[model samples]
Target: MQLDLTTFILEVLNFLVLVWLLKRFLYKPVLSVLDARQQRIQGEMRKAAVLQEDAARLKQQYEARLADWNTEREIAKQSLEQELARERDTGMKAIQQSLADEEAKNRVRAASAIATREAELVRNATSGAYRNAAAMLRRMASPAMTLAILNILLDDLASLSEKRQEELHKAAHPENVTTMEVVAAHALEESAQRKLGDAVAKVCGKPLQATFKTDTSLIAGLRISLGESVLHANLADELGYFRSQDKNV
Candidate 1:
């Protein structure tokens, strides 16, 4: 099975021509299909990675925004609480001041009213006392008092000297009684005047002159005169006489 050199060379050349034709047509087309599939898969993987990174950034931003909102809410709540407390304190203080002012005003009014009432009562009491004094004085020293004085004088006559009695008789004679007059007015009724005249006669041992004269300033009483010596027995004069008598008694 040994071949000749020229025939072996021709067979080798034909085999080389077949391999070149298969590589150019079938092998190159199949390799190109596989490379295109690999490139498409790599592009899809790259797009997925980029989307994941964007999602992470968005989640962080949302968390930050929520925390800022919570802080703002807390600050607003504290501010509202402070404002409410201030308002409450102010209102309570105002109410207390108003109450104190009202109480002061009420006390002042009560004191004023009391003062007015006291003044009115004092006036009424004083007026009543003055009226009572005037009336009592007029009654206590009148014809009745004059009669009593005359009786006392008569009783003392027995003890007096004859010379002194004579002197008294000359001064109080019936002839001297002409100028003497007893004080009287509407205050001295007819009965009072008659009693006064009797008393005067007994004291002087003579008939006395009596007259009804209205001197309203004497208020309400009698005045007796015998010569220059007068007994001004007026309503106002009675109090001194009674007080003197009380001291003696």
Candidate 2:
């Protein structure tokens, strides 16, 4: 405790100089390092937040795209199935129509062939019928050939002069008659009528009075009457009789 002012003042000056030197150099360097570290930590936190937001947005976009693709594929498959069904229906219809057309054509051809065959058969049948009838008439009429000679009797009477007309009439019968008649196809200008008449008249022994027709369908001939014998001696009936006769011969 001796009073020393010079020493005390020197110690005080030395302490002030040390504090100023540490603030200007060591203090400023330490504070700079601490500030840099704090800034780095804040920047890292902000970056992490941005990355999380970006990941969420990408996930949502991919899900929406997948849904749209699935819907498009289903629509395409439906359209293809519909097209196949339509094509099958059209093909089946075409095949059925073709079969129907062919059937119609075959029916027409079959009908034509049958008609032609029937016509040929009819024609042949008609021709053969006519020939047989004509021959039958010639055979049966042989006796009637005498009637052909009777036509010459008129000439004999004429040559004898008018006086012979009365003489021949008186010689044969009390009456001289003239008559005409129609006959059937069977008796037609055919000798059968005269031959039959001559044969029949021979029994009665009546003077032969006659005219002949190959046609015998006539209801009567020469105005002659018998007990009950009527001959079918009509004019046009000759056509049917001859048609029938021709086939057998």
Candidate 3:
């Protein structure tokens, strides 16, 4: 509590010296260490920022590549689907065309078969008709029928056209034709033969020699032969003609 100037002054001087020693050794070294640590921390922070920027750029690039891959996959899928559809259509059309062609061929074959069968039936029917006609005519043949047909033949020769008469005249010329033969299915009376000879001579425009014969195979009417020319008015010849026509059918 008493005033001690000299002692206070000595204490103050010792305290100042201690403070100077501390600043020179401890304080200076501690400040240097703190500054170095601060510098190192700042360098580490800058490195971290650079790493973050690189990571962001890499992520963006990965995202862009993924989008492009997705687009390409979609396009490939659509193209494959279109190609499959086109192939299916082509196959279906080919099958349909083949089926149509087969159907047409079958129809043609059926039509041909039907036509052949019909033609055969017609031929059979016509043959039967001709046979019946021949049989009926054979049953009706007789001497009386022959005489009647002979009269008709005489009438036809008498009424022949001018052109036909000329043909007969030329064919039965006296020098070329030695004899004009007349054959009948039945025997003829002398008066009938003379009348027939006179009628033939008149048609030939000159007198002609006559010869007569009989054959029952004529069935009816007469046959007149002059050289290579022969004329028949007979049921047998008629029936034979019908048979030939049937065969043609």
Candidate 4:
């Protein structure tokens, strides 16, 4: 425990020299490595921040694009549905119209067939009635009926209008007439023929050299011919006129 000043001084000097050496070699190099590492870490952090920002922007863009695609798809789907609906409606209408036309045609055909059948039935009934009347008239024919009809004919000739008398006179003239005849279903007496000829000649304003003949087809009356004109007071002619009217109906 004696005071050793010289030794203490040397110890102090050595300690100080060691400290300087450590600071210059170890501490300086270690400090440089730490600073470099710190700068590299800071640069990496800055790059990571930029990458994160870019990723966020890309995500936003993708989301927006996806939304636009969904909207377009919905619009396309709606348009297709609307088009199909219109086509379906048009097709249904067309089918309905065609069915209506066919039904109308069938109705028209049915009406026409019914009308034809009714007309045919009417024609058949009328023809049968005419045939019955004609048969009855043929059975009723007799000489007395013929005489009565001839008398009636003479009365009609006597009662003719002045104009009709003049027409008969012109038609029965010798130059115009080719043949004049009195036809009957029965034979007449000479007195009756003479009386009829005189009456006819009086109407014609001249003598009519009329020839008389019997024709059973006349049925029950007289037929007087003057040129193209023929006057009949006969059952057969009356029946024929009625039949012609029926046929026209």
Candidate 5:
């Protein structure tokens, strides 16, 4: 068990050589492999992070497009609704105007029909009244009444102004008619005729021929016809004038 300095030194030299070789051959290679694996891992993690960021950007773009589409659809729906409402209001106004026009036409037609009916009734009543009055007047003629009316006619001729009397006398010219016709509702007595001729000559300023006729339609009066002019003092003529007034009413 004596210490061997040479052998111990050799053993120490061999151990140092072995440590250097292991460091140069095994530890360096292993450390290099570990560094490459760590670099690949880091590169993969960086690529994943970039892909996730791209996916998030795409998702945001899709969501924004969807929101825009929804807003456009809502706007289109509101526009369509407003258009439909305007159309409905226009249709309603047209219908109301048509109804109002039809109602006005109906009212006008009704008023026209009513007015026509009233006019027809008035015409019928007027005709009936006129005929009845004429019949009653014809039934009341008398010779005494006729004589009284002739006397009144002679008095009226006498009372005429000088100008009217001259006009009447001129109308009974002897060239157109040699005689003036005197019509009565009844025949006159000879004495009455002579008296009437004298009165007629006094009004005419010259004596003229005379003719007489009996027409009961006069009711009770005298009518002296010379030419176009006729001196009428008759109930029938008065009744006709009154009938004209009534018809006008």
Candidate 6:
């Protein structure tokens, strides 16, 4: 409570000096530290904002990439499905074609077998018919029948067409002196032989002479021979000719 000017002034001066020292050393350093901290916090906040924007962009890119991958996968699946379908169809067609070919071959084989069987049956029937007719003719042989057939044969030779006559002339070689033989189932009378020789000479267009022979196995009729050529109207010759024709059929 004592009003001392010097003490009061000194106390005031000392207080002022203390406040100045604190401001220069402690308050200024504390304020600088606080400012640096504020600046660092603001910089961190800005960096965080930039990072968030980049994260958003990355998320969008990832989603777009996923969508593109899904689309590609779907396209690939469709292509594979189409390929498989094509392969299956091709396989089915191949199998069907093979079956058709096999069926056609079977039909051809069956038809050929049937035709062969029919031809064999026809051959057997024709052969039997030829044998039966030959047997029947052999049982009915006679000397009178033989003479009649010989006369008919000479008549047939006389009445031959020009073309057939020429063929006979060539075969008989009447111009060439050759041995000609006339065979019969029965021996002819002298008058009949002379008449037959005259008739044969007239057909030959040359002086013709023949040697006659008898063979009972001829059944009936006559056979005339010149070298390898034999003209006959005998049952055996007729049967043999018909047998050849039947075999050809």
Q: Which model scores highest in TM-score?
A: 6
TM for every model, in the order presented, reads: 0.36, 0.33, 0.54, 0.59, 0.53, 0.63
Model 2 lDDT per residue over 102-196, tens place? 77777777777776665555446665444454345444444233243333322332355445444434433434332223233333244545544
What TM-score does model 5 achieve against the real structure? 0.53
* lDDT minimum window of 10 residues, candidate 5: 171-180
For residue 243, model 5's alpha carbon misses the true position, in angstroms, by: 3.0
Please identify model 4 stretches exceeding 4 Å from their true place: 1-116, 174-178
Worst 10 residues of 3 by lDDT: 125-134
Candidate number achieving the greatest lDDT relative to the actual structure: 4
**Which candidate, 2 or 4, would have the higher TM-score against the true structure?**
4
For candidate 1, lDDT tens digit of each residue in 1-249? 898888889878877877777777877777777777777777776776777777777777777877887888888888888887888788877887887787777777777778667655655554465557766655554555444544454455446566765654666774545656665423555765666666556555677677666554454455566675565555545544554454354
Residue 179 CA displacement from its true place in model 4, Å? 3.9
lDDT of 3 by residue, 108-157 (tens): 87777776677667666666765676567667877789778878888999
Rank candidates by TM-score, best first.
6, 4, 3, 5, 1, 2
Q: Rank the candidates by lDDT, best first.
A: 4, 3, 5, 6, 1, 2
Decide which is better by TM-score, 3 or 6. 6
Candidate 2 error regions (>4 Å): 1-48, 94-187, 190-249
Candidate 5 on 1-249: residue-level lDDT in tens?
Answer: 888999999989999999999989999899889989888888888888888889899989999999999999999999998999998889888888888888888888887778667766776676677677677766767888788887887788779888888887787655755677988878999988888888877876667788999887778887887665678877877777777786676
**CA RMSD of each candidate after superposition:** 15.0, 16.0, 7.3, 6.2, 7.4, 5.4
Q: lDDT (0-100) at residue 64 of candidate 2?
A: 80
Error of 4 at 231 (Å): 1.3
Stretches of candidate 3 above 4 Å error?
1-120
For each of the candidates, give the backbone clash count: 0, 26, 0, 0, 0, 0
Between candidates 1 and 4, the TM-score winner:
4
